[model samples]
Target: MATEGIEAVFIETHNWGKSVKFFQGLGYQLEFETDHNSGQLRNGDGPTLFIAEVPADRETPLQLVLKVADADAFEPGDGVEVVTPFEDTHFGTRLATVRDPDGRLWNLQAPAEDRS
Candidate 1:
């Protein structure tokens, strides 16, 4: 399937407040936030940046998220491993995660169908 472009960059942070402040210092405007210790920010027309707090035991990595026409239809090239199967998210998006040969995570996302 064709890619729409980058949807967002996902960052796992142990210190959510500090990370959000750091981005805000860079002029990123807060888009929205959830009580689950996560939020979305944007700088002008650029791709959105998503920050979420992760467990201290978990490794925090920057995730590059690609926007596709359909997340369920994504087919990874050779050497790419599926990390998370495509699923509908609570944020009204369908998404999946894959790891490249270098172990960098890539998230694929598509707008979920409106249930309302």
Candidate 2:
């Protein structure tokens, strides 16, 4: 099936506090923050923004997260490169990585299957 749309934007920054304030200044509200300098923010009906802090020595690129109803139902048609298969995430979702024609990477996220 086709991807639903962008679900969220994943951002990694060296300065977590500054990044959070930057987005807040742009009208995004902090939804929930983790103890480890990570959090989710939202602005009206727009996609959520998930921010994480990384070490200054680490280089992390911004990522756009796509939504899929079910990971098992996703199809990567010809010309679509699947860099990794969907796997369970600690935050409670199944995520996969794919590369576009221009070599930029995007993340695909699906609701986690029921564990019960």
Runs of candidate 1 exceeding 4 Å displacement: 72-85, 99-103
Return the TM-score for candidate 1, rounded to 2 decimals. 0.79
Best by lDDT: 2
lDDT per residue as tens, model 2, 23-52: 999999999999999999999998999999
In the range 1-116, model 1's lDDT, one tens digit per residue, is: 65678989999999889999999999999999999899999999888999999999999999778997866666777777889878899788998888877887778898896578
Per-prediction CA RMSD (Å): 2.5, 1.2
Worst 10 residues of 1 by lDDT: 70-79
